[model samples]
Target chain A: EAGVTQSPRYAVLQEGQAVSFWCDPISGHDTLYWYQQPRDQGPQLLVYFRDEAVIDNSQLPSDRFSAVRPKGTNSTLKIQSAKQGDTATYLCASSSDSYNNQAPLFGEGTRLSVL
Target chain B: GDSVTQTEGLVTLTEGLPVMLNCTYQTIYSNPFLFWYVQHLNESPRLLLKSFTDNKRTEHQGFHATLHKSSSSFHLQKSSAQLSDSALYYCALMRGSALGRLHFGAGTQLIVIP
Candidate 1:
């Protein structure tokens, strides 16, 4: 079975530029999540959706970051105006709704660098 | 609020030595799932082990962890380390209600020297 897939494995941009990351989760998975992982740090949850409905996004930066899962299978996270602090890896993960014991699987992540 | 804490940023040990990576968590949910994920260089993080039952040990790939509700800890341990064990380890927690939303710790980098 194919795992979660993310496009543009790496991205470099200047400050104030906008960028978008895409994610295609595993088939049949009901939950999708976006996380930011700074260098030397663990993944931090940014936003999550269950079947096209956002479950939580309190940690997301409302001013600059936005995410959507229109079809409940694919997702896109957008940064309106990137900053130096936004230099980090953007990870996408997914899990099924079958059981609570199921663990989320992650993608290779998009390594973003803001100059 | 939910959070995970891994105290060790870097741990270096010779091959065949015992390994212990500290992990602690705080969450308001009564039954939270705890997970250990390992990431090799240039690779995605994969599940190492996970457990929700308090005090019941879960083992995988020679690594083991036990979730202790009394102390709010789920420290990862291995009796002997190998060179192939070198990688980044993260401890994470998810509230029962928030199925896929995981709160991860700062992570611990383990370097096993042969």
Candidate 2:
């Protein structure tokens, strides 16, 4: 069974540049999540989806960030105007069931650096 | 809203010594799921242990934690620290609604010295 997969293991961009991070969750998983983890810090939830429907996105920066899971299997998180504070690792995770006691499996994450 | 708090940012211990990392949480929900996640260098975080039952100890991979509703704490502990135990530990909380969202605390870096 393959785990969650994320593309572009790393990304570097200048301030005001836009970037997108892609995530392919585990097969048959119903829930997908995006988290931001700064250096030496824990992962912070940005958004989550359950079968193409966004469950929560209150933490997402509405001004410059957007996420979509059109097919309910793959997800993409976009940053319209990256800032230095956006320098962090973007992690993708998925779970078979949100209501169950099972923990979500995480991806390798995309390390982003904004200059 | 749910939040997790890890008081120690870094903990250093000698090999064969006992290990304890403090974790406390705050939430409006009565039944919250508590989790311990460990992340090695260059690796993503993985679940170490989790429990929703109050006062019931959950053990995995030589580590154990007990969810205490009275104190709102779920501390991670081990009998003996090993060199391989060096990693960043994060305590996370999930609300009782089973929404599968996690609120993580500032990580605690555990360094076991030989």
Candidate 3:
């Protein structure tokens, strides 16, 4: 089976610039997640959804970060007015189903560098 | 208040030696699921082991981890380290009773020097 896919493998942006990262999850997966991993750190959960409706996004920075899964299969995580701290890998992952039973399959991730 | 802590930032070991990476967690919710994920260079992290029951060792690909609820720890172990086993390992917790978000530790980089 095809794994989760992410676009724009690498992105370099000036501070305050806007960027969007896209993700296409595995077929039939119901849970999609977005995580941010700073250098030398583990991936931190930013937001997650079950078929489009966000389940948790408390960790997402509302002022500059926004995400959407309009159709439940694909997702987009956007960052406006990016800052230097936003330089990291944006990883998108998906699970087979909810109830927290299935292991997540991750995408290669979008490496973002904010200057 | 829920978080994970992996004690080792980096561990360098010779091949064929026993391996161990420390992990601990704190969560108020009941019935948490512990997980270990391995990430190779330039690749997305993959699940290596997960457990919900205490004292039962979960093993995969010769790597194993036992979750001890009493100690709030899940330490990953391997009998004989292989060069291929060198990677970044992350410890995570899944609060099954709550929203079930995967909370992760800062990861341990294992380098198996041959």
- Flag regions of model 2 displaced more than 4 Å: none
Winning candidate number (DockQ): 1
Q: What DockQ do the predictions score, one after another?
A: 0.72, 0.66, 0.65
User: Of the pair 2 and 3, which is ahead by DockQ?
Assistant: 2
Model 1 CA lDDT for position A92: 97
Give the per-residue lDDT digits (tens) of candidate 3, residues A1-115: 8999999999999999999999999999888999998877789899999898999999999999999999999999999899999999999999865554667778999999999
Model 1 stretches with alpha carbons more than 4 Å out? none
RMSD of every candidate to native, in Å, equals 1.6, 1.6, 1.8
lDDT per residue (tens digit) for residues B1-114 in model 3:
789999889999999999999999999976888889999987779989988888898899999989999999999999999999999999988877444688889899999998
lDDT of 1 by residue, A15-81 (tens): 9999999999999988999999888777888999998999999999999999999989999999999
B89 Cα displacement, candidate 1 (Å):
0.8
Single-chain TM-score of chain A, each candidate: 0.98, 0.96, 0.96
- Interface RMSD of candidate number 2: 1.7
Reference-based lDDT, residue A65, model 3 = 99
Worst 10 residues of 3 chain B by lDDT: B92-101
Q: Which is the better candidate, 1 or 2, if ranked by DockQ?
A: 1
**What does candidate 1's lDDT look like per residue over B18-88, in tens digits?**
99999999988988999999999877799999888999999998999999999999999999999999999
